[model samples]
Target: MKAWQLTGFGLDHLVLNDIPKPEPGPDEVLVRVSAVSLNYRDKLLCDGKYNPHLELPITQVADAVGEVVALGTGVTRFRPGDRVVTNYCTRWIDGQPTSKETLYSLGNTLPGALAEFLALTEDALAAAPAYLTDEEAAALPCAALTAWYALVEKGQLHAGQTVLIQGTGGVSLFGLQIAAALGATVIVTSSSDEKLARVKALGATHTINYSRTPNWENEALALTGKQGVDHILEVVGGKNLAQSIEALKPGGQISIIGILDGFDSTIALFSLIKKQAVLRGISVGPRRALEDMLRKFDELKLRPFIDSVYAFNDARAAYDRLEKGAFGKIVIRVRD
Candidate 1:
């Protein structure tokens, strides 16, 4: 089998080499990986930015789609030839996140999908949406599920509500599409006018060129006729927090999902108090949430926007492109 191992804690240490295929545990399944997707977290892991350092020589991608090649004893839900996707939070098989569940995650604390063959528990896997290609299914477990958890699960978004997505990154783009499918109007922002135009084509009712208008919260406010949006999917944390607070309608929700700019930020307490706004932080969601998200994807016929596809051998180049803030999800075809 071929695998890319993170030999050490830096980008320079990723080594592609041959390794023996893994055998499944009694309750596990061996999947022949079809595709793996890159997220911003992959870049941070390569650069040694995650809080808990990953063990050396571990495989590194949390989101993937594969076909089951063999099943170990005690596994019943899945069988050989079943197409499946693993949840990013592989240990959180039931209930909300706990200290125990948080301890083990694919790609970081455990071996991940960047290999020809990988073993995963049956509890952590879901049937991949039949409408999506393997490359598209590979992109959903992390970013798409995070957006679904924030908007649909925690935020309790209604059909007539308006959603404001801060950027065109994977999570925000999924937010745009899901909000639209739920009958909500979507407002999108991007640093590039060209990117903003692309987002508009994908069902964004309004687009803001943040590069030209630095005060995008004001633009958001004006777009909503001074009432502000019902929900704001905030990715940039530090500098943008105050603006996100200002761009919410009274009692509106803001899901803090990323810190692309930086984590530390100054907040205006009075503004949040005045509007009675709710701020929620999200990690990648649980397995049941992933299942629900896949159901929605199938029902809505949602297609993920893939920016580029790299052969499995070009995984390093895929990480480099993700680091450059590419417009959509970067995919690595693992099998075909």
Candidate 2:
């Protein structure tokens, strides 16, 4: 078996090496990976920005779509040849996240899915949406689930409501589609006009170029006729949070999902108090949510927008593409 290992704390230090093939335990399954999707967390893990103390030479991605080539004893939920998608938080099977669940995150504490073959506990896999390709299914574990958790599970997004999504990345795009599917109006923000136009075609009712209009929150306010949007997907952390609050309607919710703009920030407390806003920090989600999301994808015919694809041997290049920022998900084909 071949695996891309993070031998050290940098992309340049990653090595592709022959490794022993793994077999499942009594309650596990052996998966032949078809495709793996890159996330911003992959870059952080590679650059040692995620956890400087993380053990060396670990497999590098948490999200993948694969087929069950073999099953272990006691596994009854699936059979050989069943298509499955990896789970981001292996231990958070249902309900809310716990401290224990956070400790077992893939690509962090547990082994990840950057190899041609992976052995996972049957509980850590979900049946793939039959309508999606491997790459699209692979793209769901992290970004897509995060969006669903934020918009559907936590935010309680309703039809006729308005949602403000920041950037055109995987999570934002998923938020756009999910919000639209629920009949909510979507306002997407991006630095590029071309990207904004593209999102508009995908059901974004309005688009804002944050680079062109620094006070984009005011534009959001105006777009809602000064009532402000009903919900916000706050992916950018730090100082940008102030503007997100400014764009929210009274009693509106803000699902904080990313820290792309750096980790620290000083926010105006009075603004949130005045708006009576709700701020929730969201992790990817539980397996149950992933299952619900897959069912919804199938029912709504939702397809993930893939920005690019790379071959198996070119895995490092996939990481580079993620670092440079892609409009949507970047995937690596692990097998033909």
Candidate 3:
């Protein structure tokens, strides 16, 4: 079996080794990975920026979809040939995540998906949406689910509301589609006019080039006639939250999902307080939420936008593409 092992820090260290195939535990299943998607987190993991203390010799990537090759004797949920997708948070099954459940994340605390075979508990698997192809489904586990969790599960968003999305990445595009499908007005911000133009075709009501208009919050406010937006998918961490705060309506919610702009920020606490805004840190989502999102996607016939696909052997190239930024999800075809 061939698997990518992060033996040390950096892309130069992401070595593909001929490793022994893993056998399923009593309650696990062995999945023959068909497709996987690269996230910014995976790039950080490869560069040793995600977790400086992460153990080496572990498989990379977290979002994947595959067919079950074998099942543990005690695995009653699935059997051979059942197509399943990897749940980003492998242990968190339903409802609000517990401390222990949150700790057992895929590609971090547990073995990742960038391998030929992955032995996982049935609880870590979700029935792949029948409508989606393997590559598309592979994009759902983290990027899609995080947007779903923030807007649908936590924010309880509805029609007539406004959502300000930052950037044109995987989660951001998913947010645009989900919000549009639910009848919400979406305002998308990107540094590139080309990407912003693309989002308009994807149902974004308005687009702002942040490079041209650095005070994007003012543009957001103008779009809503000074009423402010009802929700914000704050993918850019750090002081960007302050801009998001400016665009948020009183009592609106901000789901912080990324840390691309460094970790620490000295925000004016008074602004957030005065707005009576709700700030929640989104860490992907639970398996049940993933299932819910799948159901909605099924009903809406929403196809995930995939920017490009790379062969398994070119996984390093996929990481490079991710680091350079992509308009949507970048997929890795795990099976040649």
User: Residue-wise lDDT of candidate 2 within 205-274, one digit each (tens)?
Assistant: 9999999899999999999999999999999998888899999999999999889898987789999999
In model 1, state the lDDT of residue 117.
91
RMSD of each: 1.1, 0.9, 1.1
- TM-score per candidate, in order? 0.97, 0.98, 0.98
- What's model 1's lDDT at 52? 48
Query: How many clashes (backbone atoms < 3 Å, residues ≥3 apart in a chain or on different chains) does model 2 have?
Result: 0
Q: Compared with the true structure, what per-residue lDDT tens digits does model 1 show for residues 30-78?
A: 9999999988888888888873467788888888999999999999999
Clashes of each: 0, 0, 0
What's the residue-level lDDT of 45 in candidate 3?
Answer: 78
* Model 3 alpha-carbon drift over 4 Å, by segment: 100-102
Cα lDDT, all candidates: 0.90, 0.91, 0.90
Model 2 RMSD, rounded to 1 decimal: 0.9
Off by over 4 Å in 2: none
Tell me the deviation in Å of residue 184 in model 3: 0.5
Give the number of colliding residue pairs in candidate 1: 0
